[model samples]
Target: MKAKQLYTKPAIVGLTLLSSLVLSACGQSVESDGNSNNLANIKTTTLASSNLKFSEHYLTRDVRDDVFYFVMPDRFDNGDSSNDNGSKTIPESAGGFDKTSNAHYHGGDIKGLTKRLDYLKGLGISAIWLTPILRNQAVQGDSSGYHGYWPLDFTEIDPHLGTNADLKEFIDAAHDKNMKVFFDIITNHTADVIKYQECHGDGKPLFSTSKQLCEYVSLADKAAGKGYTPFIPKGHENLKTPAWLNDPKYYHNQGDSTWQGENSIYGDFMGLDDVDTDNPEVVKGMTEIFNNIISEFKPDGFRIDTVKHVNMEFWQQFTPAIIEHAKTQGIPQFFVFGEVYSGDPQELSKFTTEGDIPSVLDFAFQYRTKDVFAYEKGTDNLNDLFSYDTLYNDHNSSADYLMNFVSNHDVGRLAYTLDQSLPEASEQEKIKRFLLSNSLMYFARGIPVLYYGDEQGFTGDGGDRGAREDMMPSLTPDYNDNNLYGTDKTTADDNFDVSHPIYKKLAEYAEVYHGHEVLRKGTQKVIEHNDEPGIFAFTRTLKDHPSYTVIYNSAKSAKKFIAANAANHKVVYGEVNQQKNEFELAPLSFVIIKTI
Candidate 1:
């Protein structure tokens, strides 16, 4: 595929010293002004520097139609080995970078991703969402922060991942391929640096050496000395950069969370120090940090981490602030979605309706899709989930914004789920279910987020770390040891073969989605067929675009179905037995029909 020329504006001349300083920090430079100390003229010069030319088309595009590919950079590919162990200056108390260990860095960096732009573009991805690249805690417990969640410094890039310039190059390369980049970020907590020394009471909020020994205590009670006090990591308390986070008072300092009510909301997550998001200063600090990132990198979107853990009011303030800030930088339709991690649509929709997050990960749809496709459960469960779309603020566009996925890094993979849910099924049956589920996800009413290794058929199970296997099997020694599906696969290669069944199917689906406007951005209505077991159908319609219908049959027997507008429609994709105005969908098959 030919690369698209990213839009660029002519560089502006004349810059104040203050603007030159700011530009220098961003690796940009301007004509120096004689009055080096003059701060008054800085605003004008900086504004000129901020006038970057992004693809106007990308900036204004509706993200609902995008096909997102989420990749954990460290596990994807190692384009640079020198940055693997990170800098010698940075301390790595834990065993340091080890590709053999799932917990350590595997050397995959931004350069690796930049080198694979063609692979992703050919796979039909419109946007790439990478795990956080911020400087993370080098070591925590038995594991290292290779996953990029345990941020040590929010303002700087992790050396293990790449430098700031490497990130810019990756973004530019993606845009050159007509793809956008959505950065994953955390706001709820930082790396676990502070711990509590003693446990005072069973349930009154006393810190214990045991990380998960904290009890529920109201913020008032904690202030009154009724709760556990956290012991700051003496020398490390101020290790976090950007300076303000160094303040001990900014943390809740509560013991690890039990994931229950007040504790879950206010306590530490897995001993990661929970920030006092409710504090006005912390909120202001977080907002400024993310705002600076936006103004500097100008990402097309953000995948907010741990949104539910923070107070709803924090989002009410933070979400709009980021969006408005992007608008000021000339990106008007900046997409931002949060990870709610709830299987209930009502619970997930609250992020959008109450929290003001534009959209959230559609865990509700993911669960139902798994049940229907993997377990051969009826489509009624999925229909039920879609029924709750009304709970979202914008019901008509709910599917457009919600990020839908079959599996992600935090959960068991689709293949693993299929195998565990149907151990009795043959290998062929398992593959069938996997393809069916992915087809439904791609064709369904939401932006499809393809987890990195799913196309290559990585089948790691048991959730969490298990699901986060490397894309290229060559990086890890025990790549084939934990095959959840019992496929006996050994030595995973970064399979970029276009002919691979799953990859081909995904590419085809992406083509159809991009070729047809209705499928990308349309109103969807489920086609009910109570008598038709193992068969599910839905129709997508948009103004002035061709209406399309998608049908999936999971049963072993071919199922015939009639469309009300069948006479005007033709099969644009997928193979099915079509007879005049009737269509017979083969068992475990999917087809898309478009109104001619």
Candidate 2:
């Protein structure tokens, strides 16, 4: 089946870009350079309090203002390799994509992640988002159920990952260290393997297939006259349903492929079958699974996977129930951010305006910023990105409580996205561009999610799956079977430096942001906007407090911009150099000025 036939119209993916047109569709306000960065330049004063009252749901949560560090359990570390079980390599997988197989398992689990909690805290990250943790089907010579997406049973944690008790303990420990946990949840589909009459638990072989079981008829497919098929062996299919639904021991075996279908028209997520969310049985099952997790682990929030693939009406109906359940369980302030995967703020507004999840990932900002910094376009591009405010600024609950991220598990890393065409430039020039881009994320509004291994400067240029590589111990090469890619940076003799200068600089700025409330919660203004290309400058002000003016010299050579209004500010946050009157920004440098 093709994506156009699956869940949503295939055009929905591109619809996000269309929605961007709704913002600043007519024209925008442009403040001039006079009293630029000036705290007093604001024509009207709207006051925001450090102690602003929030709906009970957001009261105990600080996620909206903190930096989120995302980790893939299997690729991160083997805290205790004893958890390593079965063959590391799975059968029928595409061979030698990358030795590390970040997508596959490598003995990472809750224990492994917890062992490094201190390391994350040291970097000023306040939240950690871990990938799925449920049990998946096991196959011989395969990575096994390593990545944890395949759900054998929503009720139990995969023994390979650890016990339910271990999961709860990980959350408790993270909270103790002041770190929030975002548990990944998948309600869209289940594993492909199903039951067989001949299969025996004792010595009988497990059935395995790359094809998966999906309801033959979905709304998207039915519209095109695709016929329906029963998922369970209503008569005989019920008997063929995986025995794991009957017994946990059979959950790992490779089951029959006869059950699978191609629900491609629905969404881009591959392999797993799309559920008929309209079915009350399906809704109830998913909701129960969600609430049970909330009650058991008490995750600070949830990162819902493939949200748009299902009906928004379903989300409008189901998400509220999930949030309400959390409150009922005495976890009133738990957060939820869905994955809509579009670059349109207007489209995302539909999700936020609904009374369910708090916010969706801010893909709009990610796309624009990519065009802005990486491409070195004009200052107008920056203005265009911020203009989305008309739709997102005033949400039902919090204002501007969206997730702002530059890179993640699903996209190419920022370093990978940076300009690699400058072969003649020195390493310092490369590092400068990297730090400048990261600085924007560190100081910008909303939650910032740092992809796993980004701080260590992991680089990859491939699409989604190719971007998710295992974190290397060091930046050196080592010849060993354990080092799959032969890109092992852990060896002592290899000088492949993993200490990314960009991450260190960003971490330092992140600390500064933590101490300043203004940057975290303030009214942002674009002091200067130009269409000439490159140069861009802006300011953000917190009522009754000093404002910050940021200037970026985007061209290949030094450029000049007058901070005429910037001089009036009381405190300037950035460096003051020799002949301070003329603040010189190196090519691609970003400077912050405090208005007296």
Candidate 3:
């Protein structure tokens, strides 16, 4: 295979409060902007993916062909600063834009995203996955819902981002360029409107005591006299849409969740009103709501939020309905994956099998291989990780569909992870680690999702607010103090530097990835692994196509291996250093060979 093109997202941070959906899952689409923000004049991408074309075998679109770029709308860009105040006179409804605080909105909207489509495309992206863009509870407590998680209205786009029509234009724009879009939806809970009097005293919404202190009372415990109750604030009873959400009967009222056993499924998420997913009315309502969302938005797929927190039965019913409904609406290839957040492969498999999710964010992939790439662990550790791939292989779901990522909105970035794990390491060493982590992700068996700002080498001090920096530029000290890869530019400066080393390096990798059908969809087998940091080789073979060998060196010094037919094989990436029986490898480097 010579070359083929396609697929790219930022991540979840508004992260979101979907409607009353528990265990709802969706899929990720791959994309980047073609405009490149005038980057055509800034610098020509040496391996710009525009020239690459997918083979005939992959002409039809599928989620696996995507490489999602997860973006938090508010932090990405500010195309229209006018809406930054949310077009409201009241400060509460305005969703305050405070560049001084990362917790507040910095005014990135759908318009900004629309303005930058070429930027993503020039970088080799084919799809876009934005964090919840649904109208949200603008101001929640002291923190703002700039990340789009606290949904005040699931029916509309947040005023701070743009109007619903603007979203349609953004989608239309992407589609015109042959890209897909995925909505990061939430169904487990809504914004924290339903509060407990037990925590807030006499229908008062504010409390000096944190809601986390409100002790949980399980349904079984409530049956035996230990009961916890919730109430709607006097004036705010009509807060939620679809009318049914205003009633207390629709919720579990099991108090806040510690994210432990019983409460994990039934309790509120960070005090947000948790939906009673097992209830019949709630189930039907959520199904109708998301189905309507699909019909209206016409997204290619969905990236469902908080699957594990919802009951399993909710998923068994919900996922199938979503897919079937999508088919009826003419979206036969609609994708649906969930956020399980667990690292155990066996437990991870359950969601795909019994839970009925199509795929899940590959947390197990990161957890299993993070140490190997970020730390000093042996390359052989990856064998144990890949061996568990079969666990996800079943009727409805397969390991191949898993959305692979090195870091996300909830988790700190690769830059931060590399620095934290190797605190004393040089900047170059950290860059090498970042590149390596992504290398494994790009060439691996799953759909690779690139977090927004990672290509710019954004170093989020940690996850959450720390990770959500402004791509346009920043005035925040917390973000400016941090270091970035390949550039001296801080968060205070505009970061869409096409000339940056990491960005170019990733573009090169994406070029290789999108160009090769086997690398994106082939079955992989470990050819060599060692207890020490050394050569880790694997074979990716698809039936009727030539087998390919992917090789890498995790060692600091050059490593040696032997490949007799190295000459016959076409070197797709990296140099082949051979001396009769042995070949040499650069530190933290890799090679891909299409074996004849």
Best by the TM-score measure: 3
Mind sharing the TM-score for model 2? 0.74
Question: Candidate 1: lDDT of 94?
Answer: 29
| Cα lDDT of model 3 by residue, 258-339, tens digit | 8999899888777788899999999999999899999998988888898999999999999999999988887778889999
Where is the poorest 10-residue window by lDDT in model 2?
15-24
* Decreasing lDDT order of the candidates: 3, 1, 2
Clashing residue pairs, backbone N/CA/C < 3 A, model 1: 198-207, 205-228, 473-492
- How many steric overlaps are in each model, in order? 3, 34, 55
lDDT value, residue 254 of candidate 3: 78
Question: What Cα-based lDDT does every candidate model obtain?
Answer: 0.72, 0.55, 0.76
TM-score of every model versus the real structure: 0.86, 0.74, 0.90
| Cα-lDDT of candidate 1 | 0.72
Q: Which should have the higher lDDT, number 2 or number 3?
A: 3
